[model samples]
Target: MKTINNSSKALLATMLTVLAMAFSTTTQADGHAKPGDFTRGANVWRDNCGRCHNIRDARELRDDQWYSTAFHMRMRGGLTGQETRDVIAFLTSSNKPARKPIITDAKAPTASSKASKLSGKAVYNQTCIACHGADGKGTLPGAPDFSSAKGPLSQTDDILVKHVTDGFQSPGSPMAMPAKGGNTALTDADIRAVVKYLRSFSK
Candidate 1:
């Protein structure tokens, strides 16, 4: 009787341990994309996704595309489920169509005024400064050395804009330049402004 009781207790303990481990694994597998996940996702994106290429705008892809891309990137970037989910949330939100301006009939700034207000430095600071240093010297391993005359900054405005608008992976380099610097909010003019800002580094 004593032996049987001991055996039973040991079995129960083992069973409990196994159950706890199973629960933990399951929890990790199905991560929650709770509120504010996008904010976390942005950090993950900056840390992991930015290493390879320009952090593409989240709006560049569709909902399903974001899901698939996140999955693919999860394996590539070795991202956890929670991180992947957060990135998906951020990307999907960015992809949503822009809402039309409200018809409040209130006075609005003129197009020229709005255009004039768009500063190249502002766009660079907001978007490009994350990977590229303030001096355009580059903060990452493969980032172009804008301060170097032989660097990518030597490229023409059209080429620079194209690279800025679309991702570019240079030969013999492990890192990549992400399209639009991962900020989907930037317009074509914004990209042009950033390109102009980059040119200032070469002069």
Candidate 2:
């Protein structure tokens, strides 16, 4: 059995990208399509996509465009139908433009005041787990280790939530985490939940 080298993998990824672009310019909706889990898709993406090349920024494509591209990738990457759907979910969800909170309600929870209906662990699994890993030690290079006493998790909740909301690049990380971990749908409360959850990693 012969193993393909990194250069071979890189070449393959490039070819796949070219093929994807050639595959379609129009969005085709599938009525029977099953929605993929964003978090699972993130895990699939992190664990697999980088094997071929540097991961493309999710913001580079429209959600509809991602559907076609993800399908193309599915064929080339030998991803399962479910995995393909998951990747599509991850791509489409991760790419949306960030929306700032419009607080018209006088009773809205302030950023400084913490409240969340979603559990911190739930938020972490959904948004933060892809890069941060389940252990909080990080799955990507330069991702902060949550278990470290002096790491990002040790920061105050206010700082952590702000960072999650605004996005941040670690000193040596090859890539920066997108705001709200690329889930613009996440609320201030969700960020706070994940932040609080992540803190437990250090303790």
Candidate 3:
């Protein structure tokens, strides 16, 4: 019984030592930026960083991680040394806890009982064909062809709706697909109809 007690005590001591080392490493990795520095960083980020990348919500990365990421982006985006440091200061200072995005079911408006309903194809031609093309083959560089068998429409309806509404950026591409083709007037139902139309052409 005495030997067993001694083994348990030694094990507890070793665990405490490991925990202390972990805490020390974490503190060194995530040193805090100076206060009031984030505002300057924000301006720098908007001028230099906003052109290529979306301003990520602060909760995405820890203060330390953000510094490292900003340094890398500075090199890639050709930002000046001062500009990079200012942006890092802003990201770290403005860092806050991330809130969960609210996900709600978007309901489509009901068609009038006596009115004729428009077909998805009709909607596509009238509204979408200009950008997406008649064959659902997008001609623009940033646009993806729905009929090409390599586009996002081949995925599920939910994914298509999200992309169409929220938009996306291809890695290394300078341009991004704007939300609802950059038309804020598009309703959730309109986006859903477009998704349906696009999916029909998937090979």
Candidate 4:
């Protein structure tokens, strides 16, 4: 093959640089929306279903049923392809009956638990914002309005933490919220951060 001239090499380098920049921009835009993360899946589930459907029923369906329902709901719910897969993964994993009895008030995780370095705002944005809107008034009917004077925020931190850790249903809400908002990977520290962040909305 003929050797490239200096000008040709410079032009090729410029083109390669442009391509790299475009790729980097695309990756940044994608951010943490990757489909396989249990956390992202939990966020997607809350955004799509928590507003209208009962999130506590994930265990009631088989894997195939979850798959079928996710696909069917994708268009109606406006789920991206990534979100559809993520929620399916969430449902599949969540469906298994726990062999060990669930502890309602498991103490704060020790050094062995999965730890989160995210600050309270970051944690709330990732996990809680989907159901609880940015204003903390709640995005949908069943979610408690954190901004209300007598709402969930009025409770002491310990009660709020326990409710989030163990799952809770408001007295008249349509359904119960799943523990750890269905991420299941949250540590007590993360839950505390989220509770703290949510408290900011009321104050």
Please report the candidate that would top lDDT against the real structure: 2
Whose TM-score is higher: candidate 2's or candidate 4's?
2
- TM-score ranking from best to worst? 2, 4, 1, 3
In the range 1-203, model 3's lDDT, one tens digit per residue, is 43558889899999999898777753332233333243355556545654676545444578789878987987788865566676776566445422223543344333311232555676566445644667877644455667865666557889877776666665444455544543444556776777777777874
The TM-scores of all predictions, comma-separated, are 0.50, 0.73, 0.39, 0.63
Worst 10 residues of 2 by lDDT: 25-34
lDDT score for candidate 2 against the true structure: 0.80
* Better by TM-score, candidate 3 or 1: 1
| Model 2 bad stretches (over 4 Å) | 1-32, 102-114
lDDT of each: 0.70, 0.80, 0.59, 0.73
Write candidate 1's Cα lDDT for 69-113 as tens digits: 999999999887788887776666545543334643256643422
CA error at residue 28 for candidate 3, angstroms? 67
Return the clash pairs for model 4, or none.
Answer: none
What ranking emerges by lDDT with the best candidate at the front? 2, 4, 1, 3
Better of 2 and 4 by lDDT: 2
Q: Write the per-residue lDDT of candidate 4 for residues 61-156, one digit (tens) a residue.
A: 888998879888887788876788788877776565433334443564453245658787887776677667788887756789988758888899
Q: Model 4: which ten-residue window has the lowest total lDDT?
A: 96-105
TM-score of 3: 0.39
Q: Write the per-residue lDDT of candidate 2 for residues 2-38, one digit (tens) a residue.
A: 9999999999999999889766744333663567888
